[model samples]
Target: MDLKPYANYLRAGSAMIAGLAIGLLATVLSLNAGYGFNSLRAGPWTSWPHIGGADIDPYARAVISRSGEAPLGRDQGLAFIARTDSDGAPLDGACDYRIVDPLPAARYWTMTLASPDGRLVANPTERYGYSSVDILRKEGGAFDIDIAREARPGNWLSPGQAQRFVVMLRLYDTPLDIDSTPDPNSFPKIVKLGCA
Candidate 1:
């Protein structure tokens, strides 16, 4: 007798339910894609694509390295590689690190420590980077940079806690090939000196 009204109500309800389901599915797919891309790009096995014969890790390499390149050109080259402890996990933050390396031909080089979440460590001072320009020279022309929570007498970086930290290496005016093939050994290593 009143079938028309009932049918109209049913159709409207069905349409609303269908729209909600579609929206939920789209959201889930978007999130999955984002996480998947990030995982692959940041994973240890990933390598940078070849650009002008440069063997850089395009995704994880510092933003500064892409200067004059499309899209990311105005970005800073500040790529970080996580340092692990003897157990192969991330090193504790409260400990100090003696980061050392032989001088390179580039005009400048720097080592910066960042929290696991990619933010600068929250130390009393707002310092983050240790550059060759500021670090004291050592025997055999090598440089020793200290990273700890407290300020040291010489070149010091801040590692706010004893959890996970990343060390970013920046080499200005470095050859394209050098950027392409970043030597793992050249990066800073986290050696546990003591607790803060």
Candidate 2:
């Protein structure tokens, strides 16, 4: 009996099925690994969506006020809160941010980008923060900050490959004209330039 044709067909079928199974397994494993890594990395800092008006943390409350100012002991310094999404959360990786100093004659200001893990975003230039003094501004003293995956022309800070990031604004020694109250008008407004 001639069984060569039957054997060849069986072998081909088995190989095809095996290849498909391997590919499926690989995809599932990759997804699982990615989720596990993110969970482990987030640890306790993973902020869930704020529900209702109760059970709010002090830090979250400060962020909600949009007043970047945080109490640094007895002294009252300049600080402004960065704006977030409609859900009262920080913008994800794709969104670009521009932080402008509210104080017109403010001498110094800085915007530092940090990863979700609370570490400074690593850049090739070894610079993790953007400062008004270091950035190039127009003659009238206007500068813009670009936060995205790729580098922009001026005042651009790479947010790394992470899906989440946070921007910390520091208005160093702001002018005495500004009020001490924590209000949205007291801080700089972070305008969304566009998507990366």
Candidate 3:
């Protein structure tokens, strides 16, 4: 007796549970997608320009939280990230690269090589990055850094066994508006050479 009402209630509860599960799965997948996190794009680089700031969106927050990466607010500075070369090819340790960076508007900046998971890639050189102060510049403040699986003459970053990697440029105590787009010529360029 009254089995019909009980069955109807069970059906509704199951449907609600299934909907919640599917929604949660989709949310997680979207957030973890490849560099698809909420960010601003400039040329080949992308950055969560407002990270660690009040302007950060929910997706950016989730990404920062999950990655455990501490970012500086606008007043502090900003970060620009590049995972591809000037030709839009993903950077590989098997290939050699030349990163030409002109004088950025920031007060101080550092270029570092990191694995996709954000950890510094290991190498015999034990060189992971070059800070503005340490870089050897040509006549002007512009400089070129070498990136490869092998050692280079100067300002070199060796990714070691890491098959793929990302280059991150962090500007600290900067006064420039990093969130805004700038002339492509103003930013650095990553050129890939032959791969081994």
TM-score of each: 0.54, 0.51, 0.86
Give candidate 1's error at residue 65 in angstroms: 17
Global CA lDDT computed for model 2: 0.53
The lDDT for every candidate, in the order shown, is 0.54, 0.53, 0.80
How far out, in Å, is residue 139 in model 2? 2.1
lDDT of 1 by residue, 83-161 (tens): 5642354567767767656433466666677765446777666778877677777666676778777788767877665
- lDDT leaderboard ranking: 3, 1, 2
Best by lDDT: 3
Query: What TM-score does prediction 3 earn?
Result: 0.86
Q: Could you report the Cα RMSD, in angstroms, for every candidate shown?
A: 7.3, 14.4, 2.5
lDDT of 2 by residue, 1-196 (tens): 9999899999999999999999988755653331121110111112112211345444444444443323321122343333363235566777776655443345676777776434676756566787776887767876666776776787878777657776656555545333232334434456667775
